[model samples]
Target: MSRYAEYRALAQSLGVDAVALVPGPNFVRLMKQDFHSHERPLLLVIPAAGPVAAIVPNLELSSFAKLGFEGEVFDWMDQSGYAGAFAALARHIPLGSLAVEGQVMRVFVHHALATAFPGLKIVDAEREISGLRLRKTAEEVAALEGAIRISELALAEVLDDVRIGMTETQIEGHLIQAMFRHGASELAFGPIVAAGENSALPHAHARDVPVQPGDALLFDWGARHGGFCADITRTVFVGHASDEAQAVYETVLQANLKGHEVTRAGITAHDVDDAVTGVLEASVFADRIRTKTGHGLGREVHEAPYIMRGNRQLLEPGMVFTNEPGLYCIGGFGVRIEDDMLVTQDGCRSLTTFPKGLRILG
Candidate 1:
């Protein structure tokens, strides 16, 4: 069996003539190379039972050559545009119905394909295509561990210097620098460094507001290393915590622990989420629940096998996801504790080791 066998089978299973890949997680996984998907168009087409083919930009030919691709290459120039390449690919493979990544492929590329192959059927196979990466490999898990290590080290360094008067944006600056200093190739996403009531917003952005004595400081950040991503969120108190704040923090902490306790291979994603959310719903702050239990994590921060209600996807060994349970009171404050979880044969293991104990940072 060839390396393309799985994708070929996927194409056949999807009832499409071929599966088209753009420069994204799936493409990178197969090609083992990264290409920027900018104004130029780069496409790889894998038919169900034939040699694969590709449409490469003239400038990327040298880079694309490194892949040792066993197929015909239709290269086009900038001045001439990519229409010719697409046209040539259309003639070579003559695809009738194709599967594409709906979220990754751009509209311009879609138009180019449509124009080149008139009456071509393009099916959005986002779920099926991305689902291939749902279960992580041992190598992928190592890469994610490296990313989480860098992120945790950066967080520890940032927390050591955090004082009561520093602004949220200032703290954010410290975090970015610390991640790179700790050897992060890239940020998984923009770090969230919200303070006080701003932390109440699940996806709050850092501001210039200074940290206050009795305020909650939330940091939701991750680092990307070796093509994998690590997402971890920790909420801390600035100085002294109010009685209400401690209660809320403890409630969210137990809910996060419940997720860990219930996750294992053979369990449904819905079961893990139901067990986690059940704790929160049974709490006095049940009305404060704002988001789902968590999401799948890997090459992309968000992917398949989403951990939430109504999702029946079974949790399997080697699958990685975020066990994040948060409670937010719009104008008051929020408490969220997030951890990267790897599902094992017997149970799940937390990839994030940063302490979850409520600590007073000054």
Candidate 2:
């Protein structure tokens, strides 16, 4: 059955008239169309029964039609405001309680929708919609694998030329070029090229600072392929590393490995996180830990079934998540080892394989 049909069934079960989707990863997945966001509002209405309806700007009518949209389209030109289109949509779909992506829809659009149907009851369906995409199909797993392959290939190519004195931005540029050469549809997220003291920040931005020997060069990056994403992180030394740096690297590596080791079909998401944290807490660098153990990965870089403390969500087969553990010290350096893994019937399999062992580059 089509995703829309599935969603319609879900809406019916929930006593909702229809489910609305805004332009984003979920919308792209449902429509299978690649289009940019526009100033004009566009709403896709999938009702419990009958054809779908869309309110698209006149300029984008042709592009939207590429989906061969079988539903009624209420297109409005730039000269006319979208009020009429919204009214027309309400006339067809009727304004009752409707499900919407609370996370992706803009406030202006929500207000416009409320104006269209004064009695319209908006239900936040973020969890319901996200649940639809929580598990990966065979095709999705293969696509994720392809993305990881491209990322690993890119890292290997870029690391060959990495040397001391090169700026983080330069390294980022090389990584980008290599990903494209290796056939990445796009980057999953901005490449993180944190070095030395900068690595202490979990989401540090690439700086113009020159890489120096003894610095922990942490790279957290991913590639997009077929709309699926692969996130992986590996920390390496710029040159000869200090004894302290190597020890931190080993501690994080062990935690990462333990995270994967404890991930099985019957375990809770918290179990995986606790296992990793337990490993780190036993080490001397326990207080230096940063960020959660991992998060779900797929169409969007981060999704549902987040693997962290306090989450008791069961680990099911076909579910994919990252197992990243890190130790960061201010004014010193940081070490993080991340890998994407797939939960199977028995245990979990690591999808990202960019060697977690500390490598001394330059």
Best by lDDT: 1
Whole-model lDDT per candidate: 0.94, 0.90
Kindly provide the TM-score of model 2 when superposed on the true structure, using C-alpha atoms: 0.96
Judge candidate 1 at residue 271 and give its lDDT: 97
- What is candidate 1's local distance difference test score? 0.94
Which residue pairs in model 1 clash with each other? Answer: none
Stretches of candidate 1 exceeding 4 Å from the true structure: none
Q: Per-residue lDDT for 1-362 in model 1, tens only?
A: 68788899999999999999999899999999989969999999999989899999999999999999999999999999988899999999998999999989999999999999999999999999998998899999999999999999999999999988899999999999999999999999999999888999999999998999999999999999999998999999988899999999999999999999999999999999999999999999999999999999999998877999999999999999999999999989988999999999999999999999999886
Tens digits of per-residue lDDT for model 2, 179-263: 9899999999999999999999889999999999888998999999999998999999988899999898898989998987888
- In candidate 1, what residue range of length 10 has the lowest lDDT sum? 1-10
Return the clash pairs for model 2, or none. none
Total colliding residue pairs, candidate 2: 0
Model 2, global lDDT: 0.90
How large is the C-alpha RMSD of every model relative to the true structure?
0.8, 1.4
What is the clash count for each candidate, in the order shown?
A: 0, 0
